[model samples]
Target: MKTLDLLRLKRRQLTTLGAAVSLAAALLPGTLHAADAASAPEPADPHQWLEEVLGEKPLAWVKERNEASFKVLKARPEFEPLRQDLLGVLNARDRIPGVSRMGGFLYNLWQDEQHKRGLWRRTTLAEYRKAEPAWETVLDLDALGAAEGESWVFHGAQCLGPSYRRCMVNLSRGGSDAQVSREFDTVSKQFIKGGFELPEAKSQLTWLDENTLFVGTDFGPGSLTDSGYPRVIKQWKRGTPLSAAMTVFEGEAKDVAASVVVDRTPGHHRVFFQRALDFYSSSSFFLQGGKLVKLEIPDDVESGFWGPWMLLKPRNDWQVGGSTYKSGTLLITDLKAYQRGERKFKVLFQPTATRSLASYNLTRSHVLLSVIDQVASKLEEWDFSKPQAPRHREVKAPFPGALHLASLYDSELPRDELADRYVLYYTDFLTPDTLFLSRAGSDERQVLKSRQAQFDATGMRAEQRFATSKDGTRVPYFVIWPKGATADGSNPTLLYGYGGFEVSLQPGYSGGRGRAWLGRGGVYVLANIRGGGEFGPAWHQAAIKANKQRSYEDFIAVAEDLIAAKITSPRHLGIMGGSNGGLLMGATFTQRPELFNAVVCQVPLLDMRRFHKLLAGASWMAEYGNPDDAKDWDVIRQYSPYHNVSKDKTYPKVFFTTSTRDDRVHPGHARKMVARMTELGHEVYYYENTEGGHGGAADNEQRATLQALEYSYLWQQLGR
Candidate 1:
């Protein structure tokens, strides 16, 4: 039989048996709370309960569940079909609509077509009335060839244009190192002189004026291997030579860039540079009309990590914008008055627990705060006229899921015409996205433009389920299942998660994962595990330090529940995670290899022993313990997959993948793990892309091809 036909035959057999296995497991269970600690107090801290149930290691439950789920999923004869469909869905190109207001016109960038190797092109639309309207290209990564063809990639362009006639594109390149460069040009499309470049370092550029610019550069202080990007902000002028870069503000110690806002008053121009080392430095000088005064926001020494440190914990929120004349006010969030140690902040509007102060823009008097709260996603306007006392009111609108704000343009139109009128754009997990020209506080809203209406979320269900970790903590995950799947279980499921850093994986529609995976017969689950900013800061802190094993346990519980609930048996179950999630997959695989039939590990950091010495790993030491320290190493070594691979044990079919250009998590981690696993007589598939950064592939075609190969491999293993 053909490979696909064989897979289909195996899938059908597994589906029929999977239902029986799930029912048997559920009926054979001793008690629902058997996983809980017997002697633990009724109101014991969830962490303590987990320790009691899972012992000091706390990964036992994951192993147990993996075995149980694997059995049930494997029983299903239709398992391979569903698994293939899931993989196929993730391989297709699904378009999303993106809009930005540029040159006084609403421009849309939508998925144009599947280019070479299944990559999607983001084509721009200028929305002109004439038949032969001009088209401007925003980003063209298509020039970056497939992963098999290249060894480097350029991405993340922060473009700024002081006037319509001139623009500056600040882009970062990733290969051996993350480097930043500035491309200067006139609005008339003429190249300018004295561009800036840095090698083997990460940098960001902010334009102070048409002629002056601020560049932040990070240099490795100690041995380059052990050093981090200690930052210094420099000033560069148009006519100055490359060697003439002048230092404007230097931090007392290891200060990194937190935030930078530029304000121009009547007589002088001021720049606010907030450093991560707990200091805010401002540069103010006399301009043509008004006196420029630079102010530094002092850091609070008390509370340490929770103190008023710009880098550690930002205590204030300031919005900077201009009016019709490019004049705006700065609104700061005052946390000094609140009792110090409280984890929460009171703002003008209800703050989304998952969102930070990152999604706000400030004018002189009003603050536009984007809130992604549960039911409604909105922007709240706060009037900070009184420095000590600020007032806030909600700005009503039709747009929801406005988690990201592009740029707030200054309108010269009258208040009667523009006060209620504002340009709003946003996208959600199910919504393709839309741009609107409507009044912020007005009831009337009009859709100015949309891109890729072909995107749809019909008959899809997004369910939020809570899984109790071995430690008893309630972990929330969003599961997206097909419309007709039986909740009684017996469906092929792919569980996904990324639980590191305080970054919350907000529910946004993903064409790559959705169209390629879930659109078929597969179920997709996004585990919002700990070490993320889902609930609050405390939620993340609970999963940090020596208690980090709770994150792995939390992921395991979800997989176990899926099996006990009969979603699919273990034979058809698969798990995939990248980056920190890559770490997650490794931990899960080692702790409970039998729980999954196939595992896809991408650009993973399996070698925890040397993680800190690689790329940006040193900077994240605060999050993960210092493995060099004896006590820390003891705990880290317990779950470090690379160190724990045993010659006596058999692991599931595994694919260790990475990109040669992945400077973030060095490809060495994947290479070392693959080498070690292969040496141990384990079957492991290794495919390293030559291009793309910490993210696997550079272009759409490369991404599509990689996904296809990945899905094909996954289905061949688990689907059968």
Candidate 2:
């Protein structure tokens, strides 16, 4: 046998032996809560009672857990300091006020310690260029919430454009996904007494014209998908009841979601409809002559129009015009020509082994592409007005970090003064955020604002490292080391990872993270493992569903690599992740309990078998296979953390956090896991915030508190 193959075989045998020993211990006698990994799975979930989201019993349980966690975390000496420091970052007024260009004004939603709920306001371009531009408040969320006795969170507004005089403003109670939408007059600065309004539910709204709207919302029963998102779209005219609105399109209940976006770019006004078949797959359609015509593109490809050019980004390879465009390639074609049955496409951005299209933003005549080269970011602009097709130009920006570009151009309003201008937000691990304004396709950029450094990085450094996984795939991760840190394995290390949903974890400045962790002599590591889009769709695709174990293995490889490098031993290592990454934390800690001393699992999907049944969980079946399917369950059960929790095995003292208002991932995931672990005699810390939806916080104070609690947990566990 080949040497590499021989080595792999021996490694697998050793791993199997270790797993067998763990499995034997898992089957030991214990109070049954969640199903044991080695035992025949329980037909009914014992802790399923916790899934009662707002039930009296569930809230009481959540309260007790929160109190217990607070008593421990709040007692830490570092907790208050961390909270105050992080809160200052959150409430800083000098932080760049990100704006959206509309109606000859730059609009922003400003939030601080004073205006914790947020203040929607606007400023002229000339004023915005000044150090402290004067702002005219469009809506005061704190005032509105107080007036209405509601926890109103600004969900954004969809304004009718060309002349953005009127808008449909959306507000949610406590930052939930479901929102209450109402029409308002921008000039009058008041909610229209008899204008369009929608009751709370996940909804999408786009103005078709001054008198009409295309809305996808919960009409009633059967109007929502199994994932709890809009499944039916309708056209509602002005001065008409919502019930009287005519149905335009209806997607299946099994579908993930349905949404619509109407572009009113002068003569190029168009309506785009999207049906999310699954999390990573969707079909696009455009309304033509009052009929919905499906856009001829792959289901997994994102289709959109920028000026006269139609952009198509495929998540998988596309074979067209006698050529195969690789996955993650950005292709553009004339919108009218493509609609008239032409297949020719010009490649705007192509992915290489080291380069992938991270994202793109559209101006009137250009599309700025954020290209990721080996996890570093660069910008490129493609001008569509070129005769030979859109001419590509490199947009000069700071490198070796994340470059976030947003166009000030109002595509819906073609006659715009800011049509050619865009905003660039740049940041790195040790650098504070700097916002710049530049004309599209040109290097004439001007610094608009820059934030003060949040933490001392005098002797701190950030570097990338790669570790080989069990399958021989090399995984990349970044480490931010503090001053005087050495290879003695004595420093406390906090490693974070999120390896799912094609979401690429890039280097970005987080003031709260920096102040709470790095500023206090803690080393921070970010793992860019499989199941993330750091390399492209292939990177994410290689670690999903039946291959999901690959992500867990990659994370383990990174942890093992850190230990081998003597950066930190298991005693001082703490790992954290949220949402999909929360599942990563659960599986990793359960699979290799001795790898670390602390695990922070936030809003996790623990019970894979019942994940699909949870709110919004059905949409993620594309990433994680349907556990109800016996064949899929066979592979999933191997990594299902809730099912794999062992009674006799030693485990890290895991800190689990979730929100009672989290309508996306059920709080029960955290609740059941904690309950099961506690029942199995494993002491664990649990915290369930009362508000903040899936984010676990409603406002800045809540955000700071949660962050402080987490840092305190890390210090208590890893500081030793």
Candidate 3:
């Protein structure tokens, strides 16, 4: 599940901690207020002590809870087999070796039983296309970790443009967001001696060239945001003391963060300074002749440049050049003209009540658009051969599943050049992922690879169904079940959701979920509720702050829809979510305890009252209203799982999962909530992995084990 957070990891990685940096020269009105100081005096939260993440008492409490939960979950009859089966799927060598385009090579990070920490290897484009390519290992993470005596997780590397040999390799100690970045020479396959390096912190570094970097980190006092992210961007040169680096930009302490991003598209090597004012909004600036020039655009808009076009995807309505563009509109203008005060925009895509743009990528002469109509995938390729206007053509997908497109490996051409080749990945609840290579000017698409099905899906079928929500709005959901399964209200069904941050919940291949749940005749449901990009910004904005309960209500509507259709009863129904979705689960089970039999809330933010005071929580105030605001708290406290828990209410046995090393959402949210619930005499199980970050697993083994534990708990509770 996608969380509203960003981290220092490669963009290709499936997970992120939160949004990128936000900076400001001065504090906005009320931005510097203490998050912990409520508008009114508040009663002490008895379990508050658990918020001390690494404190002795909390560790002891965590250990005790882990042992207790282990006795219950591990004792399940299916736990061992489920774990072993998942392990086999995870360790399978036949899985797709996802490639990254860097320099002149196609790079991949592979992990298996033999190399749990993974191996950073690369190959030529031709060799990568051929089966069983000859790969050159550049970094062996397992060996490096062993040699350094640290559980080093490879965050990723930012290589210099063009030649792309020198890079800043980010390494996390035990899967935390704080990581140490070291300069490495890809050609030599070794760390560069006397090269640039940044010690561990939630940091960001972009290469201005090989010898200089735009750095943002915890640089001494007052250099970090309240969210524990870098608040200053500095220009650091090689062979100089970090303290001597010139501060180029500074952000407000209350702002999320500020960092520099260099568009490494060769000739289009533009440097940008971004200030994430909050989780979903930011102001961006482009460096021109050593001066920071603010881009004339809304802070809520997402802007980028491809070729000669300046692109804008606005989350709010914008009025420019006598045209009022609606929210969720994608507009384009000539970059030179835009800089010269030409506000006229070419409308590329617009969202309807039922359709919204999920993602878009620029090719050499076209823009590949991935739009979701009612949560179903729709592909469109717009040819911008003529800069004045572009001709659009819809590319029909070969199969019925969620389709995602990416450029071919090593296609890092500049904006002026074409990135005509792309790889399309399509999959759903039952279908294994299949990859296809498509060229901009070609009609024929080549099948590049297909993942082997981890579980037999011979009789399984996926159906899209809608349910009426509390506000009488229709909510869509996908249910994957056996073809012959009847709506007898007896099937053990698992419902998942992540209804925040405009993140669309699209269908994808999940071998672990398929094998652990569906292979056992269990049903899986993905709810496309409000507060998501399923229908775009309007859909998400409909459930923010005071309206946040709408998302929970929408989720309940889907749950009730399943029960009303006789698909599953509350006694047989379960729910799972992480990060913001974790908040969804907590709110749901608390507000409507009778609706679900089990819940797997992982790396969640439960204690809304103090969430802002926690690591990275304050940054998300845009998505979730600040608790310090009494007006906002009035609504927040109404559904906050921690504040809403009651001793008199009977709650289902919930399994709380988190990572001690998670530097994003503090593990304290889970620990304190569980502690409070247990104190209130509720049935709850807890497990805190010592390593995994916000995603809750550092590697596949931990991932499989965690999945096993979750599935085991669900089955044991639902009587599957």
Best by the lDDT measure? 2
lDDT of 2 at 417: 77
Question: Cα deviation of 13 in candidate 1 (Å)?
Answer: 40
TM-scores of the models, in the given order? 0.70, 0.94, 0.94
Residue-level lDDT tens digits of model 2 in 269-350: 7777778888767777788898889987778787767668778888899888899999999988888898788898888889
**What is the lDDT for 392 in model 3?**
84
Judge candidate 3 against the unseen true structure and give its global Cα lDDT, from 0 to 1. 0.81
| Poorest lDDT segment (10 consecutive residues) of candidate 1 | 16-25
Segments in model 2 whose C-alpha atoms lie over 4 Å from true places:
1-42
Per-residue alpha-carbon lDDT of candidate 1 for residues 1-720, written as tens digits (9 for 90 to 100): 111122122212211000000011111112223223233223311222221211434334324433443454444553445445443343333322344443354344322244322221122233432233354544333344343253234433334432333444333343434654545342434335555444446555566766676765554353122324435556778777645777665544333233344543332234455444311221222222333333332342111111121112232333222211110112233333332332233333322344333245434344566654532356676654564565767666544443444433332212222333355666665666566654443346566554453334578777777778887877777677776877655666788776665445556665555555666567777787787655534455667658777788989998988788787778878888887778888988988887888788877877776677565666456566776565675566667777667777778868776776666676667665665676678877766665656657654545565665566556566552
Full-model lDDT, candidate 1? 0.52
Q: Is 2 or 3 the stronger prediction by lDDT?
A: 2
Local accuracy of candidate 3 as per-residue lDDT tens digits, 1-720:
011234312211322112110111111223333443354345456677777778999999999999998898888988889899999998987787888777577788999998998999998767866767899999999999999999999888988856778999999988888999999999899999899989999887788877899899999899999888889999999899899999999879988888777765545667778888887777888899989899888888888777567889888898878889999889888888888998878788988988799888777778888889878798887887775667988887855668888865232454322257888888877788887878875557877778888888888989899999988999999999964678999999999988887777877778888788887878889999898878988998999998999999999999999999999999999999888888989999988889899999988888887788888878778888877676776677677777777787889999999999988888988988887788778889999998988878888889888888889999987764
- Model 1 CA deviation exceeding 4 Å by range: 1-134, 137-161, 164-166, 171-177, 180-182, 193-201, 218-230, 252-261, 265-268, 278-346, 349-358, 363-366, 372-407, 410-431, 450-459
Ranking by TM-score: 3, 2, 1
Reference-based lDDT, residue 159, model 2: 89
Candidate order (lDDT): 2, 3, 1
